[model samples]
Target: MTTDTLRASRTFSDWIPASWAYPETGATRDLRFDYMRGFVIPLLFATHFDFFSLLMFVGWERIGIVSTAEIFVILSGVVVGMVYGKKVKRDGLPATMPGLIQRSVDLYRISVVMILLVAAIRYVPWIDSTVITTFFDAPNNQTYQLYPPLDGSLSTLISKALLLQIGPHQFQVIGMYVVMFILITPLVFFMLSKQRVWLLLGISWVVYAIHYGAPFQSLRPTGAQFEYAFPIMAWQLIYVHGIVVGYYKQEVVAFFRTVWGKWLIVASVLLSLGFMFLTWNHPLPHIPQWITLNMIPAETFHYLNNEYFSKSKIGIGRLLNVVVLFISIYALLTLCWQPLNRALGWFFIPLGQASLYVFFIHVFLLLAIMNTPLPGYKDFWINTALHIGLLAVVWVMVKKEFLFRWIPH
Candidate 1:
């Protein structure tokens, strides 16, 4: 009954709730990034589930040119830089290569499995190929096809899947990750060690620039096969910059705390708003047009958007969108961490921590829902229920560590 004993008991009780009970991790681990990842996972799911009502809130291209994919890519780069970069410094590159190699192998293995799994579903007697085809087809007739026609020989299909030339279109991002980890990541670490950060960035920009003139046709091969959705050269720009920021996180944080850092944030906010206005009339479906500012000529708007804000190529506008928004958001989160973390952190943090697991498993859940005889996209309430249900299922799986031992996540 002593006051100290009572205080200790209260503290223990506070830790009982899931919000306060973060999983054990290294002291250096930043839960903020995990929370952001967790937040983006459901948005990604909602966007992927074609015609879901939730798209109104978090749909692709709904808010400016950026989407959850860009956030995920940048966060992935930051984490790699923070984790592997530190390891290189502590243990040297020799110790770091194995882990990077293993990560690439794991990504490749999972990607191949997903591709083969989807392709195998075609042969299942009960499952209709139409469902698979329908699922892959874009609602707006955009060529987002990831499923290849199995009309070819089985060996050829397998060969293409192994080569990462075709697969479940959802997993094309993973294939890109495999390639980056194998090739670009090590080079990033090497540059960081040698204090060649500018050189690394210069090289990344050069590669991204090459996309403008020649357009890196190899990644998006012209054929019947499923091409890579994210061209490696273009996307690497985000990931490389993420790595640089993550590796020097402390220095970066300190800089942001200074007067110059505050000015940068202010500039980022203005730039973000400017881009938002510029792309207000973007052509993507489901993007809510709250403000109608027809400032630019229609012809000029379309041409500029296609050339500068194109998502596939990580166009200049798109890159700028990612940068300004990332800075603005990161600053806001840092300023409001305590209350925001307490409010929504419980739900998202766990999901974010197990993001890869949720990501991989959701593919099956999405396939199941699409293949089943369910309510069509017309029923808004039903679609909303289904989307919420899908997120709930994955959240529970993550919290329970469902299949944690077996899955690469």
Candidate 2:
């Protein structure tokens, strides 16, 4: 091989990673892609994730909306990349494995810090363990199981400090969910480059479905691991899609303009909203009658009765909601969000770029004071103000020139 060929084979990735990772051609393009690493894309997601979070937290007796929101968006990011990769290859673009690796490394490093924070919540001194008090608990726990209570013991302090072994019996915790993404995202790049996207998606989805135990609905949460949960899987779909779209810029944009794309978007949205309403309220709404709203609690039938939806299976409503969400996000990129064509940018783009910092900080702050005798959970107005206030602080720290370097560099 020629000297030039040897270098290309080694440092960059093999199998044509992603065209989007590099500019279409020369120096300017490469720089532009790098700048993207800084902002705009992350914000689009941050808004959407938080939007759902607000919805999830709207009333009484629901999961922790903010935590669920954070995990979903992060997982969805992986899905976006997976889907985008396939489209890129079909459009005759180069592969993006090398770029994907670079991104994965960035994510891994972030996970490391989150792991440490989880440890510190159990042992760190004055930083107020409140930020990460819930780190020790299972993902979907109620009040009593929030976290490992701090014991002020030396052994517990040293043991819980690392991601690998928190204590004698502690499993690898903290951002292990993110660790799952780092492991699997590169595989997406590999499959997509080979035009085997449907195969990969099919496999992932089936695994996801079985993992959900939807077919058995009455199943209990036994050996089920956190990796296969649908809420997380739904997010993974987003990252896959982004990768596919980036790969097949021409094809995706074309599809968006087609009538089918428009119809897909509309139908998905209407159905998603309808499902949301039905899931929140039980009674299943007679399908023939039209959109129905029952103010009664969903638990009356689904959980309390142990009749339907009690199983871990992915119900029609939840699956459809996932589909609707997926198509809507994709539709924007295909239709108007032609990232390459536009020189214009949104103002929140900068803030969005440093999204991980915001995400980590926001989670830490919320959990820190979560269970203390603080004025949250019960005080709706105060909690709303606090959430908004936290957002502002993070925005300034992350976006403002003065403290930007110190935010999390």
Which candidate ranks first by lDDT, i.e. highest?
1
lDDT of 1 by residue, 149-223 (tens): 657788877887888766665655666767777778999998889999999999999977887667446544323
Instruction: Please give the CA lDDT of all the candidate structures.
Output: 0.73, 0.43
Question: Tens digits of per-residue lDDT for model 2 on 84-164?
Answer: 444444543345555555655665556555555565555545555433333332334432323335555656544444332
lDDT for 141 in candidate 1 is 61
Give the top-scoring candidate (TM-score): 1
TM-score of 1: 0.85
TM-score of 2: 0.59
- lDDT of model 2 at position 37: 35
